[model samples]
Target: MEPSSASFIHLRIMQLVGYTQLYYCPKRQNLVRSNILVVYSIILCMVVITWLIYNLVDIEAHWRSLEINSVMETIEYINLIGSGAGYINSIVQSIIHCDKHLKHFKKTMEINKLFKQVLKVYVPWERLRKRLGTVAGGMFLTSFAATAYILMIALYMKWYYYIRYWLLYRILYNFCSLRYFESYMVVSAFKWTFDYLNKCLQELSFLGGKHMDAYEKKNRKFGLYLTEMNYQKQSHKNSVYFRFKILRNIYHLQWELSKVFNDIFGLSLLVNIASDFLSFLTLTYWMLTTMTTFSMALVDVVALFGFLICLVPHLLNLILICRICYLTTQSVMVMFFQASRTALFVHKIPHDPTNESHIMQIEEFSLQLLHQRITFSAFGFFNIDMNLLYTIIGATATYLIISIQFYLSAQRG
Candidate 1:
């Protein structure tokens, strides 16, 4: 298989986050790195986990000591829950699923090899590399800026009481950001593969149509016509059979790859989405509470800045994940339709034992596509698609209203 720019970028980023130690060694056609790095990765995860526990306890105590209103108190709790979820997700990715990550990485490489051999599609590695680099760089910069701004604000506000907690939270948040970016690249790769499959199916449809048109245009005597008809029928059948067979294998491989992906990332996705949702809820609630209690002109600039820094990244990350999942699923649907259309075209041709079997293969392929749908989900709880985004927004709004009501009641009392 040719070099993949996305894979290279993903590996580097994953390494930086201590998610994996393996690097592609082209000569060996395998991922190679020291087992010691794996041990180091485990140690890093342990350290992060330890710090997260300490920070959570410290922050909780600090929030309680503030004697804030009910709404503010609730938001603080939600914030801790969200941050905890994210930390747990990082732990799961780096420690528990470490071996699975290695196995899936190798499996995907093998699948890519098969795709190249079967489909013969040209992937623009250089273009992909530049695009992926820009995205990764942008995410890193945004995360860095957010961290730096918060640290600066902590200094300004003299938040010495929980400054350590903020530092630990930022570190954990950056790790989560790295994982999110890596997942995006993986889904993007899947999207690219599905697109190429769709293109292959389109070309197959065109070839079938051309065959049908040529057969109709030919003129021959009755006896000669019968002979030519049989020959043409057999030739088209053979061509369609070979192509469909290759496509079937590719589709099956894709299905297995999806399973591997789910195994590796399913729980992590669940917690990541949960973390983002909770964080978004907490930040939006805090913003709303501040606005209701004080005029915009009188709002604390440092607090407002903190809200923006936290809110924007979580919101953008949520949308990015949903959009990619939706697009990848759409590509799979397009492939399904193409296969169905190709099968219908084949059905119109004269039937023989060979053509009959070809039609069956096509039908089976279509059915497999429908039955074994390719979807990204949060451990089967809910799909990670655009609809999920809408659901999240609606849910957040509902909770925000409830929290505000509680605050109003508490003030009255």
Candidate 2:
């Protein structure tokens, strides 16, 4: 749409919003790493070392060997049941540790006076931390369960316990590495969403956010004109007035939908609930099928049962990716609504094909730019990696089948 006569401030905000979308990245590694996992592991080791030194000095070597094991055991339980303590700690440390990112974001926001609400990086970080922490917790528990199940399988197969440790830890290491990268993607998604949303809303404001410069003010004035046009006792067929009404409705719908995420950092909870529901289903399947062993049909059950149970999360993960795609597309819809309103408003005016064509061209270009500039924060701030999470499920199922088979066989023999 042609730049409305909104204020220059809002125009600048639009630019910032655009640039923000281009640059927004939560897990650049150079700037931020969830570090929660690394930190927790370190703390666990420290705590274990301290305890062993005091009480197990006589069995120092053996205890030392088991120190990591003990810590992992604790993490497993905490993750399995959910630890409010961990969640609380994430909130508390986010304030201190996130200071640099906050300062940087604030400094950047200061460059543009219009969007103070979004300038505070704390909100985004809070948003990111909450969800990332949940994923981490879920990962910790699932991994432990998978590893234990694997270990049991190896044991039933008569493998050495030491070998089990080695094999399991290798898998654990790969998981940690992949997860760290996945978290990066989530962070990237957050930044992308925030920047794009800020821009789209500011433009549609018809007025502006907290700050509107010359262009935005002009746009606002134009929007005001449209509003007034609607109020006048014009015919329903008055194209200009009708156009604004349609555009206005579309913008309203978009905003309303976005507000569903307005609970500060509540997206994390919503996504987790989704994941857990899927997990519940998958686990329930496994529990039920294991009972099928009571039937004489043993070989076929042995063949496919574990595999399907394991694939549960992978299947759910497909839905999650679709969800992320849908959300991203929905966000783009807000921008489209604005552009659509602009077009309708222009169409209502007497046709100046040249001017209308130019406006349409700009609208298309702007949409493209907006899409390209989308950041990570937007997509994954609260989203989990259902993709990589599939592996954990797969491991768990394989381990379960092998272990349970051995258990049943031993009983019969």
Candidate 3:
């Protein structure tokens, strides 16, 4: 009944599901007031979309008229819009999925209070909140710095023809940056989920020992402790019940979280992966081409390095998400194996603390754990993890090489 880390995660999940806000039931005024914000947001989104489409068309025409070198010069600045497009698409997908996710999560929570409570207990909110705050602050600073640097470089270069283009690009950049903020939310959820599962594994490991300890205490003292033995036995029995309850809840929570991940983030992740892939490829191409002068080459190197620096948070986010999800699966597997060992050991020990019901429930939980599957996939097409990251990098490198070869061939022709 006490608030646990799992409870905190459920609170966050509710916030994302929109049941707390979007469907807040009260006076009619509350519904109207809540919807007013949604209406305002939709209007602003329409404006941004119209503005971006116009600029993208104009820029594409302009770039076609420019020489190859001139086109390449803008590649670094312009392809950012592509990343922006991905981010924008992701935000849109989130909006589309919001209601459905809300309905699904709301129904599940109503039906399963124990799962909600257990899920929240493992979140470690103090540490997670602090880390989330730091991540947000860093992202804000980086965005501000990057914008200032772009403005300065534009003024120094005095490329008036591209000034309008730059402004439009930055506008898109600002809009797409929302994707990162959204990502921060998703990653934070995952961080809490993975951390909770690890805690569950620890609880599972100590479960059998606790039972054995209680049994040993009763035997060692014999009739002298008979009065205390009943109390201790009941207490330990409750403890075993609580631990098994947590294990059962964990399996259910994983399924719920995976559904949340798929509904709310599937398209968004696809957008992010594609956007990052293109950004990295563009940076690589620019860095490799400026070999004619040391100063020019030095500038390219710096640009590439700075670009990569900016990308570190996003890249690290991807890797951490994958690692946490993957590790949680492995941990569950370990827990299942430990349960088998405990069951075998329990049979060997006389006067076991656990009742037949406790053993039956655990065996059921272990079987469920075997069948459980959890993954963060983009649009259900591919799982997002370390393996996906490696594949993206390899694909990007291959394409970058091919594009360079084609460009050389074009120049010769």
The runs of at least 3 residues in candidate 3 whose Cα sits more than 4 Å from the true structure, single-residue gaps closed, are: 1-33, 60-81, 101-123, 174-177, 220-235, 292-356, 409-413
In the range 1-413, model 2's lDDT, one tens digit per residue, is 11122223332332221111112233651223335533544464455345434433333344356563543333332322222222232233333334333343333333222232332222243454456456545655654554555455546556453343335333423232232323333333434544544464444344322222443355557875655444331332233333334333333333332332222223323333333334444444445445665465654454345434333433433344434534554556566555555444333333344545535543654555355433222224443334334544576567667756775687689
Which has the higher TM-score value, candidate number 1 or candidate number 2?
1
* Candidate 3 residue-wise lDDT, 315-366, digit = tens: 5545655665565556556666766665664333333455566667667776
Question: In candidate 1, residue 323 scores what lDDT?
Answer: 96
Runs with alpha carbons beyond 4 Å of true place in candidate 2: 1-123, 161-173, 176-184, 187-203, 206-326, 342-413
lDDT of each: 0.75, 0.39, 0.59
Which one wins on lDDT?
Answer: 1
lDDT of candidate 3 at residue 357, scale 0 to 100: 67
Best by TM-score: 1
